[model samples]
Target: MQREGSPWRGLGVVTQKELSDHLSSARMLVIQLLVVVTGVVIVLVSLQQIRDITAEDPFLLLRVFTRSGEQLSFVFVMTLLVPLLAIGLGFDLVNSEHNQRTLSRILSQPIYRDALLFGKFLAGLATIAISLTAMWMVVIGLALSALGVPPNGEELARAALMLVVTIAYAGVWLALAMLFSVLFRSPATAALCALGLWLFVSILWPLLSGHLVNVLFPPSATTADALLNSLSMHQAFRRLSPGALFAEIVTVLLDPAMRSTQQSQLAAMGLALVEPGSIPGAPLPLLESVLIIWPQMVGLIGGSIVLFVIGYVVFQRQEVRA
Candidate 1:
């Protein structure tokens, strides 16, 4: 809607152009194909598994997101796919223009750099949202046709909320990728940096956290104070990883039976013993599930914002001389 003289004149046009490029890009198409193909395969196998496990389970639709073949759940698959897609979409967003000697030309237009950066980021996120929606609907439709079970209101609500969470989760990676795009001149290097960070945070952080706990608190000090300290330290360190945060959010949302986030395992067992007669396997109400995951969502969104702000500042100050 911006006019000729406005600084934001080209924002919408640039966003649409980028959106069209993403929709038509071969890489984007391949990523979406992989997601849909794997999702379809997983949902097919999971349906049979669910049938064998429980016929009258109320949350069968919800199970599609968390259940999969050979210990590879759909949510887990996204832990790999989402970040890769984000990185691919953004790793060259800025520097490629510089390499091609087009950045200054774009900057010479009646538009600010903010519009360009924001537009590109928004376009990447829109791509994620669109691709996720397509695959999510496919899974839900197939689950409905195969399972022959009607999803209740609550189940549908949970799925919708989880989709929103998926977009937000993708946004974090998009922001990080954009940050790398601003930092690195070479696209390959930016991608490597993002992928390396993802690998370390997802794989190595937990092991390091465990080692730290063991080194600081010996097995001999398994008493109350040391155990509490160790648990707190592990929690503190794990929260540093966005993957850990996203996983916790997915677990609580898709698994409606999840009540508390930080409750110790021993405390949970004690509570179970005390409430033996209470309702078993009951899903939490929708509002309560949102409340339980509020902090997780906040952390994720805040992390994305911080990364985006850093990218914004860097891009603004970056010398665009080509």
Candidate 2:
């Protein structure tokens, strides 16, 4: 039988309900508090270091986000924390309804499953976006108060792009958590699976990429070009993980003078120093930096969409009888 009306007939209603629940939930409160507290400490530490070393730097505000304190920069800290926040919010999204025996009843209403699933995902993403935006503003405010200098137009633009990229990174994990929730009936199992996958991608993948690259591209002693080829392949495997993609995108966006990705920046700069007429440490135009990391940005967004589609299909096929 053909269904009537739009698949998104009650999308707005479902979104509003879910968003309200997410924003008001105790779980959200804890996650936001943890992120905000850690972020503030890291930024403040970075501010002190920036003041002492780079007081005359033009991009002082950006350093507050990229500079490291106790070996942890705000950007790196977000890369680690964002995934956990996403997973916490999404790990039980669908399974909790099933465990409560409410899934069937919710479907019994006029709303289509499409709207229900999409709405929940959107609600989760919006919550993360709001939290990140507020934290970003707070960090900027603190930096301005300490450094006594406001960010220029380009610095603001770069920071905004970083925020967008971080949200996209969160979406990737949120979709993964929701996918596991749809696959498993128990919420604990869903959360465990989502976290296990995160550990593998964020921690283990980088460790193994070099080994895998060597196995695929083995060392070639005869040709000088062999090393470059191997390094490129290694970077390729590392970029498969969403964490690496996020790091690469922010590396260039936060540091205008950085003309190379993390993997190649040091080597590229060394070469520039020796080569006559080459300008080392010169900041690239904002547009040029965007162009360099554009592929990584696309990869992060694409990964989220792929994960969401997989979950959508699984949810659609499963039977939810009362």
Candidate 3:
């Protein structure tokens, strides 16, 4: 029998309830605190290093995020921490409902399974957006107060785009965690699988992609064609990892001088041979930077949607018995 009424009838109600629960949860609070504290310390450290050259740099505000002191840059730190936050929020999203025996009860009401799943995802994404926005604001306020320099319109626009990209990056991991949550009944199993995948993709994948490329396409003795092919293949493999995509997007968005996302040995050689008239460090227009990262943005958002759809299919098929 066809279901009656709209599938999204109670989406707002479910989203509101889930958002409330997430906001009040101690797990979320602790995660947010950890991200905030780490970001602030890194920003402060980087600010000290950037202070001396404030006059020389036109985009000092952007530098606050991309510049690192002795540790990681704020942008890199976010790349690492945002996934953890996303996983923490979603690793138990569906399993916890099953464990508490609330899945059937919740669905037995006027709510459809569609509303419930979508609402949970929207709530988690919103929570991440809120946290990242607050972090960005804090960083901006600190830059303004410490450096007494205001950002130009273009700098603000670029930072805003970066914020949007970061949230999309978080969504990819959140959806993956939720997919695992739907697959496994045990929350522990779901969380472990999610974290393990994250570790492999974020840390191990980049290291292995080059080796895998070399194996797949051994360099030829006489020509650079095979070497170029290997380098291209390596980048393609790296882009499969969301972390690599996020890092590339952030690098270009934060620094307008960045011309391309190509980081291979061949790309470095190509850059060295650029014409003498080429301006290497000239800032790119905001639209040009967006064009550079448009594919990466699509990849992150597309990955999230694909993962969420898989989880939705699995959730719809599974029986929710009380």
TM-score of each: 0.90, 0.94, 0.94
Off by over 4 Å in 1: 1-7, 217-229, 262-280
Clashes of each: 0, 0, 0
What's model 3's lDDT at 311? Answer: 99
Q: What tens-digit string does per-residue lDDT give for candidate 2 at 8-44?
A: 9889998899999999999878977986797688777
**lDDT (10s digit) by residue, model 1, range 80-119:** 7778778878888888889999899989987988889999
Question: CA RMSD for every model?
Answer: 3.5, 2.1, 2.1
Return the TM-score for candidate 3, rounded to 2 decimals.
0.94
Against the true structure, candidate 3 has what lDDT?
Answer: 0.87
Total colliding residue pairs, candidate 2? 0
The 10-residue segment with the lowest total lDDT in model 1: 266-275
